[model samples]
Target chain A: MANILTQNDIQHVDYKDIDLLKQFVNPHGRVMSRKRTALTAKQQRAVEAAVKRARFMGLLPFIQK
Target chain B: MEMETNLSEEGGVSRVYEIGYLIVPTVAEDSLDKVVGEIRSSIEKAGGSFIAEGAPSLMRLAYDMTAREGDKNVDYDRGYFGWLKFEASPESAIALEESLRTNASVLRHIVFRTVREDTRAKIKAPTLREVKTPRTTLAAPRREEEVSAPVSEVDLDKALEDLTTE
Candidate 1:
């Protein structure tokens, strides 16, 4: 599996402040489902909403197809 | 003196009332101006004294209505906000509400009574508060609370014993 946390691992992906988002997210890029980043469903939703708002405001890049 | 007594005894013919309505977004902007003009005429005809008006704000609806006549596939409709404050008889408000309910242009309407003498007085005589109040410092209260708590006797004894031993 490609390393999700590393910016280099995602090819042609659009992300606003890739470094900042990486720092906020888990090392695996996948949040939760692990003990190190023990975030619940609510926390996940908050993160998703923040990311969506950032994208809509042009602060973050939308994921490229 | 007899006319004044009769007028006072009859409970007067005036009351301060507020009417507000929301216009559907589908209504053209030009149509909105026309609707407002009609309302102005309606108020004048009803013998209501217009006081003030509130500006429009874009707000989300609590629920979506699927049954607008012109809109076939409307997921939702935008509400154009408006408010009118006036002095009129209670019966006039009832008549206005009935008219608004029958009108297709209005998305929602409500009328409320404002009878507080102080509220009306403030309208006529404005207060002078030209200067904005400065925000108070929060850190000062925390520091004062910390200083007010009594020191533990055990801790004081321990400090004195350490000094003597040294």
Candidate 2:
């Protein structure tokens, strides 16, 4: 799939937006890597940071339970 | 009092803030407002000015969070959700966080400094992540004495010989 960011024309990702965050997460709740998602280096980093924040805030789980 | 790292690029010394908090769903609508109002007052008390906010909405939590009510452990499966965008002095933001931590009705919360959507800029590359505490895969401790010892063949043979001798 094309990188979700460019496909949707989303420049910045918000940690609070679960809908957008979900797209970056795998079925097992792991965040997809740049290689897997085919995201640019910048986009991948943005997702990683957002995912970490979301997980810490309980918006997303570190692992599927 | 503490200070946020980001200084406003806008026409002020204070930074813009985004706060997200989850409240236990069991609270009545009136009581919910009361709790939020308390938070608002606390923020103001610390010298923060309130900005517009979305009304709190009841939502099912992704997972149950255990909360202690009196002496009992209460499992909160649902939560009242809300987000506020405001401008506050760094000192007041720190105070707001301290108050949120002590608020009993709050199940979880997070706060951060943010730029306006219109002025949002390029993304920054992140460094490798560090390992953190595990959220799952619990290993309960088991004492060796609690496990029954396995019976050996020698022991069984000795028991048979002892019975015959008797």
Candidate 3:
């Protein structure tokens, strides 16, 4: 599968963009692996960091339950 | 996490930091500005200069969060979210974060080093690509089988007879 960020030409992964970030998170509220997300290593890192930040801000949950 | 700070030749250290905070939802709409202003003043007091900011707006939380209010822990399902981007020395930024932790009005906050440039991606609807059918004038060359003329009944009978005989 094509890398979503690369396909969209998204240069920055922002934690405030919950909708976009949700694509990188699984239903369990865990960040998906690079193989699953089909993201470059750098892109995966950025997404992971953004997801963690979003979770801290209560914009995203740490766990679904 | 290790803090990243830029040290100038003059021995001064500073870094660009962005702080995102959640204000208690109990604050009245009219007094929201005052709470935001207090945050600004606190940053200013820490010797930080403002760069950009997002005003606090009421938003639903993903989960219930509890914050101490005087004598009791109050559960909140919503909050006023805001952020400020500024330049400050590493020491002062840490100091400001410590102060915000103790602030009763602010339920949660985070300060992280970032660049001055706007790195946020604009949310936009995906554009649908137009599907174009091949034009008749530019149609692909037909295969031999498809381009071949239909066999006459006599020719078909002759071919069948020949096959049977073989």
Best by lDDT: 3
lDDT of each: 0.52, 0.74, 0.84
Question: Which residue pairs collide in model 1, if any?
Answer: A16-A61
Pick the TM-score winner: 3
- Candidate 1: C-alpha RMSD after superposition: 22.6
In candidate 2, stretches whose alpha carbon ends up further than 4 angstroms from where it belongs are B1-12, B118-166
Q: Show model 1 residue runs off by greater than 4 Å.
A: A1-65, B1-12, B66-77, B116-166
Question: Which window of 10 residues has the lowest lDDT sum in candidate 1 chain A?
Answer: A7-16
Candidate 3 on B1-166: residue-level lDDT in tens?
2334777555879898999999999899899899889888988997778989999999999888998787998999999999999988888888889888888889999888887767576655342112356697368776567567898999999999999999
Q: Candidate 2 falls in which docking quality class?
A: incorrect
Q: DockQ of candidates 1 onward, in order?
A: 0.01, 0.10, 0.38
TM-score, every prediction: 0.43, 0.68, 0.77
Best by DockQ: 3
Q: What is the interface RMSD of each candidate, in Å?
A: 25.6, 8.2, 3.5
TM-score of model number 1: 0.43
Which 10-residue window of candidate 3 chain B scores lowest in summed lDDT?
B123-132
Ranking by DockQ: 3, 2, 1
Which of 1 and 2 is ahead in TM-score?
Answer: 2
Instruction: Show pairs that collide, candidate 3.
Output: none
Ordered by TM-score, highest first, the candidates read: 3, 2, 1
Model 1: share of real contacts kept = 0.00
